[model samples]
Target: MRVLVQRVRSASVTVDGEVVGEIRPATQGLLALVGVTHEDDATKARRMAEKLWQLRILDDERSASDVSAPILVVSQFTLYANTDKGRRPSWNAAAPGPVAEPLVTEFTDALTALGATVQTGVFGADMQVHLVNDGPVTVLLEL
Candidate 1:
């Protein structure tokens, strides 16, 4: 599993012009673009969730674990896109929808189980994500 974690002041997801999920931080929050590969399982999903919670990116020397900041998760298989060889990116590293959807759900559920206030984008849907990226702080997480 891989995630692009971005600190955000606020974030939202829209599908077909309807807002699906939205979050505004009291302080700071995270917008997670999550990806699932063929090898990713519940264990990897769980570990990544835990790591995101503990990551010390927030101010006041606090972690999301410390403040219980909200998280907005979006399924983003495109994270695995490989473009080294050609103009058309190869998606071979990404798991197809049937294989990936459940893992994405599991990842979000695991984060919720860990007490995160988790919001999500619709899996397999065309989504528009909007965010005010705090600090422009972005990090790639993998497990």
Candidate 2:
């Protein structure tokens, strides 16, 4: 599992011109792009969720856990794209949808369990995401 975590002042995800998930950070929050690979499982999902929740990347180095900040989670299989071979990218490293969806849910569920408000984008759907990046702070995590 891999997650790209971005601290944002506000963010939203739209599918087919309908807004699905959105957050306005009263104190700062996260926008997480989640990816899954063949080796990822519920355990990895849970761990990553916990890490993201507790990660101290917000203003004053406060964590989401510390502030009860909201998080927007989106599935991003493209994080696994391999462009080393040629002009075309290969997704061989990404897990198929059936294999990935549950793990993504597990990840979000774990964050919710940790007391963070979580929003999500529709899995496998074409999405447009908009955000005001707070501090332009971004971090990547893999497990």
Q: Which ten residues in a row have the lowest lDDT in candidate 1?
A: 56-65
Q: For residues 49-79, could you state the per-residue lDDT of candidate 2 as single tens digits?
A: 9999989998888999999899999999999
The residue-level lDDT of candidate 1 at 97 comes to 95
Per-model TM-score, in order, reads 0.97, 0.99
lDDT of 2 at 55: 94
Q: What is the lDDT of residue 120 in candidate 1?
A: 95
- TM-score of the candidate numbered 1? 0.97
- lDDT (Cα atoms) of all candidates against the true structure: 0.93, 0.96
lDDT of model number 1: 0.93
Best by TM-score: 2
What is the lDDT for 49 in model 1?
90
Model 1 clash pairs are: none
